[model samples]
Target: MTKPSRTYRSELRTEQAAATRRRILEAAGACFAESGYGRTTQAAIAARAGVSVESVKAQGPKRDLLLAAFEQAFTGQEGRQPLAEQDQLAAAFAIENDDAFLDTGLEFMAAANRRAYALWRALTSAADSDAEIAPVLDGILARRRKDIESAVGLIQRRGLLAAGVRVRRRVAAELSFLLSPEGYQQLVAESGRSHREYLDWIRSMVRATLERMEP
Candidate 1:
């Protein structure tokens, strides 16, 4: 049998590193969800990931791990990317029809909220006492607000917004509140609503709000 080339070996190493990083992030997320951020340590994450403590440390500190885990949860991926950079949102915005836009946009938001809701709860609960987490929380909120505003801007530009809803600020705020993780937790997690039911409810609410404001 022929041996693999150096390039192939290098690619293999890169893939292995990525896999390890993903495992560490997954373990950290589980630890945070179960124990809360205050109680979750690097050592705990290391053990949960079945890697050495030094391996976890090489990834970064606990704060970095928390941020990475949250990113993975929200994006359903390992690497960090801005919300505005998401191709799904861009595709949704490109959809000219209001119904299509709302459907696709709500679908994306609901999926992300479903994946991240538990970790979001853990982070919010921990942020109350952990000052280190406040910055990450703030950054996430700011990005969410920006994304809401961007979506609203697209709708307004398409002349799909309701006539009475002239204020972008108010519309953005309402959408943000409706699409928040807390709302998801309440409806889907606590109220026993299926993911499909929750998404349909959001779609209905968004359509009604937009129709009522349609100029």
Candidate 2:
């Protein structure tokens, strides 16, 4: 049997390292979600990942880990990319029918909320007390506002948005509040609404927001 080449070995090691980092980030997300940032320790994350404490430390400090984990949970990768450019949004935009496009958009938001809500909760709580986290939270919010503007542009192109909605600032602000994680948390987590019920609320509220705008 032939031995693996040096290049092949190098590639394998890189893949293994990436997988380990993913595991550690996932563990970190779980810890932050369950215990909150104040209480979650690297040792706990290491145990959750089934890796050594040294390995967890090798990744980063807890604050860095929290941001990385939140990014991964929310976007399925680093948070470097704009949310609108993601493949999921592209797929949703491909639908030509206005109502169908709106439905797809809502479903996408609902899915994202479901995946990231817990970690988002942790992130917001941490931002309140952690100076380092507050700037990151602000940056994320700014990015989200940009994303909302992008979405509104797409909706305008589809001729679904009213003439009044062409002013992106006002519309984006309304949409941001409508689709906020806090609203999701109150509806689904606090109010005991099922996922479907929460989605229905999103559909109704967002649709109303769009239609009620003066032309």
Candidate 3:
């Protein structure tokens, strides 16, 4: 049997490294969601990933791991790009019909909230005690607010906002609060609303907010 070439060996190593990194990120996300940031240690993450502590350290510190997990959850990948820079958000904005835009937006938000709710709650709980985590949580909220504002802007540009709702910022703020993780947790987790029911509520609220402006 012929041995593999050096290039093949190098490619195999690269694939193995990517797999290791993916495992570490998945393990870290589960750890953070289950244990919160303060209680989740690098050693614990390594154990969860089935890798050595040295390998986890080589990837990055615990903080970087947490941030990477958040990025992965939100953007469906681990990258430094902002949420607005993503094609998903751009596609959402490109939606022309008012009803279609709102439906698509709610669907996307519901999916995201389902994936990240536990992780976000864990981070928010950790933020109260961990100063380092507080800023990261704040940054996440800031980005979410910006995303909501952008959506609201698109709605307004399409003349889909209600006649009485003149202030775009206020409308964005209200929509953001309604679509927030906390709201999702309260309605879905605490109040026991089904995901479809919650999304329907969102649809109703959004439609009520813009009913007068639908052309």
TM-score of each: 0.88, 0.93, 0.84
Overall local distance difference test of candidate 2? 0.87
Clashes of 1: 4
Task: List the global CA lDDT of all models.
Answer: 0.84, 0.87, 0.80
Instruction: Enumerate clash totals for all models, in the order shown.
Output: 4, 0, 0
lDDT of 3 by residue, 1-215 (tens): 99999999999999999989989998999999889888899999999999999999998877778888877775677885555566776677677776676787788788778777777887778778878878987887887777777777777778876433456677888888888888888999889999999999988987776664453
Predicted candidate 1, C-alpha RMSD = 2.4
Model 3, residue pairs in steric clash: none
Candidate 1 structure quality by residue, lDDT tens digits, 1-215: 99999999999999999999999999999898788888899999999999999999999988778878988988778664566577787788778777787788889899999988889988888778778888778887888887787778778878787423446667888899888999999999999999999999998887777676665
Least well predicted 10-residue stretch by lDDT in candidate 1: 161-170
> Considering every candidate listed, which one attains the maximal lDDT?
2
- Which parts of model 2 have CA positions greater than 4 angstroms off? 163-166
Write candidate 2's Cα lDDT for 10-107 as tens digits: 99999999999999999999999899999999999999999999999999889899999988887777656888777777788898887888888888
